[model samples]
Target: MSPGDEHDFRGMDQGGRGDDPYSTLGGTRQTRTRLPDGDAGHPHARRPVRNSRSLITITGVVVLLIAAIAFANRGGGNDDTASPTTKNPGAAGSAPTAPTGTKPVQGKNGTIASGFAHDEQGAQSAAANYAVALGSAEMFIAESRQSIIQATHDPAVAQKLQDDLDTAYSPAFYKNVGLNDDGSTPTGLTFVSRTVPVGTKVVKMEKDAATVEVWCTGLVGLAGQGSTKPVTETWFTISQELRWVGDDWKISSSSQAEGPTPVNGDNRASTADEMAAAVDVYGGFTYAR
Candidate 1:
């Protein structure tokens, strides 16, 4: 199978750096946007100030509204929202999944990890790992791409899926992504396409089938001097419908959606050379949870 030929594999590399969820809960924190110091269209523009009494009244009204909303949703009966069971649902740094205490997959299926359990935990693990593989830099290479596809996809659809992906990762697509004719990086450039899974959730689980959503931040494009394609990051969620196949979970189908994206932080973007060195030095992870 040609590597990266799957239409579903497109946009896997869209990424940008932000607050590391591992280091802080601030990745998804919202902050107030401050206006620029100088130009207000008029150099002598002055801000209007409200009275202290009026400001106090507004604050009191805002607090009451919040209290009322909290009271209305206080019950554990809101089926429209994901309940805060394992953790506070929708909070930054919260795990959307419940713990199963099951260990990660112990075995390997070629380059991909294998030996997933047949439960919801196993399915979530499989989906997360598969997202990393399908969103990898290796997917642009022919041999490694085939290995990834075979390892993560159901055998029944692997060949056909490979053909589809082959058609999708055409020469034009490679050129668009700054790859050479053979999917190799241009001289002195480091092609960066990696998916870092932030969290996983089993949206729907059954005896033999599971729908798992893996929220991820990805790094894509190229890093090098004179390179126009600078590495970038993006937040997205890949939802995979997995089936228990041949004693392990395999992707039956998958799709990606934009995000529950967090606000961009104020961190200075790294230089291209620094990004290239980082990609070369830091190996990608075998994400488990």
Candidate 2:
């Protein structure tokens, strides 16, 4: 994929503002009128050409703009104290905690995915992506599945969850996904199983770990016309227990529960091509409060 496409995925996750001038075009600094206020040793005042009131007003506006931008990028998800916490809350005696709230941008500075600002959303985004990686089509394939499970999960829990999931994706489930009974892809149809998190919130927090619940509704199926195994959507909530392993948060354990789900909307469904194209064209987000 092109660099542009990769950038689109990053934008899709955060503000979804690919075209935002302030964010995209580098306008973190605000513009304001400058006044020549000679507040030096000379106490004599001179006639000011610039409107003092207007200068004050413009400065005030610029200050407000800067403050607003800072708030939006604060990474606390919002200013709310109850907003989700970043996995790493800084040392207590250090500067007040700056939280994480978005994904590590999968952006290539040349070819590297740009790192994200550490905050609450960042942790949740990483967790959500980890969830997707864990509950993916890859999980069925032994080697790839093992790699994914090992990479994202705590060792003990990975094994336990693996055992349980192995049973869940049984022969019937494979058939339904247009895969061979062993979860291999069938000819002409692409097998898909992805957990797309809609949003995430922190249920509780601890010094070493956090209880995060990702409310996800996923699409699972084959994306070819005239296929018996049509793509279907499923809703579930995955509550993950994340530990502050190394510097980043890792999933120590997780449990899935049937949703406090909403009823299906009356919106018309799209064709296979439409759905497939949409998935590739549009991207997912790093969710936060």
Candidate 3:
């Protein structure tokens, strides 16, 4: 298939429109007449001023109300022990999508993140990071692909997974994606393959094993002057079956699927130089759940 054609490597390494409320409503024109200053019918005619005592009473009532409101809104007691719902009042009963202030993994096996906690959150983090590794440009190369598989997969399954990936990312496949036989870009081109995790979910969790789905958006293709396979974005979700091995989570198996895609926006596409520069300047993240 051509580079533009949709292709999938099975079990391998893979906004809202707002309506204008006034649009349908017709604009109305109104006529207004200014009455004489002293006329009782005048909408802007002056009224009798309140007495000093009545003004005082009104001012006191206003002050009291303000004080009452302030007192009622002044949350008391220790903040650390407050429930998520209590702390974020209107978000009650809703799952939190914000970060929980937990630090990302501090350990690394070479460049890959390792030493995940033995829990659901850890599984999710591992899955996300592994997805990034599996979908990287480095995975197109033989040596790095094997290294990544070994680092991310369980010991028992690593060799087989590496073999599968090696076959999947063959020299022919590299050429189809506009790379050299050894998975290197041509002299004047920059090959971009990067996977960014949008979110992660744990499908199933147990004491020692977990299933996680990592939603990702990736860029893949060659970027530079006179390139036919221009860099383009793609969305995919990778499901990882993880097992707790040693002290970290390791992928036992992995598979990929097309995304829960979004409607494309009308933004102008960037040039090859711009995309290449962006990839070089901006660094990838270490995700934490």
Candidate 4:
């Protein structure tokens, strides 16, 4: 709802401190250290300090354990009011409740999927799917981009939106993303831009209009030998305002903001060739709530 530039979903940009003072004795100071059980009067009496630090560490651990227990008890269901579950990953709970086996969508619209249900759940699904389509690398090309914009956006605004998107994905932008001036991948490289939805939430809902926020993890960049822009993952949240149009939810407008990012995993980084192979072999999904 703010005037923060609607199409500001820029790609992730690739991009610490210090030590001591008052060393009068310089590096040769004769320091007296005390044992953990030493008397307090002794110049080396560090025993009490060690004990205090240990106590503080133990206290911190206990507090965190108790907080974890409380958060787990709260469960993962959508909280009526704002809570840590809405923003923080692994804040609490086990696996999410199982899906109800309901169908995700009724059919496809020109190459894009569509025909979502007409409820909050439907709005969430539409947002997630539209995010995938809009975030795909295919949307860089003129034909595919126009198709995607027409398929996902409201018809009343699709033409203007398509023109805006065309300008946004200019030749300069394509070059920046390691694509050719015409949005084609360079020789022997595969440009990857895919959005995978982690979850969706209904931020607002009404009879014929709704707003849904979809949290997504995306992979973007080029993959292959001698590629400077190797694919990297980024986390972002997309908020879509949807309208029930022609019996299905269509995006009236949308905006994206960075993060809600979690700490990186300990997995080993794969080789560029391996990443290229994986991207070639693996396929993306049509995300749904």
Over 4 Å off, model 3: 1-95, 99-104
Among these predicted structures, which one has the highest lDDT? 1
Q: Model-by-model lDDT, in order?
A: 0.61, 0.48, 0.58, 0.59
**lDDT comparing candidate 3 with the true structure:** 0.58
List, residue by residue over 1-289, the lDDT tens digit for candidate 1.
Answer: 1211122232223331222221111112223344544564654443332243332221221122112222222231213443344232233544555555788687998878899988767887899899888778787787887888889887866776676556556676576557787879899999887778888877666667777878878776678898776665556677676789999998766655445566555455778899999998999878775
TM-score (all chains, Cα) for each model: 0.68, 0.54, 0.66, 0.67
Error of 3 at 154 (Å): 0.6
Residue 110 of model 1, lDDT score: 81
Q: Weakest 10 consecutive residues, lDDT, candidate 2?
A: 1-10
Model 2, span 114-225: residue lDDT tens:
2322445445565676656655666667667656655665454556545544445567745543568876877665655566777666655555566666666666556666
Task: Return whichever of 1 and 4 wins on lDDT.
Answer: 1
lDDT of 3 at 135: 67
The alpha-carbon root-mean-square deviation between model 2 and the true structure, to one decimal in Å, is 21.6
RMSD of each: 15.2, 21.6, 23.6, 17.2
- Output the TM-score of candidate 4: 0.67
Q: Model 2: residues >4 Å from true position, as ranges?
A: 1-122, 159-173, 279-289
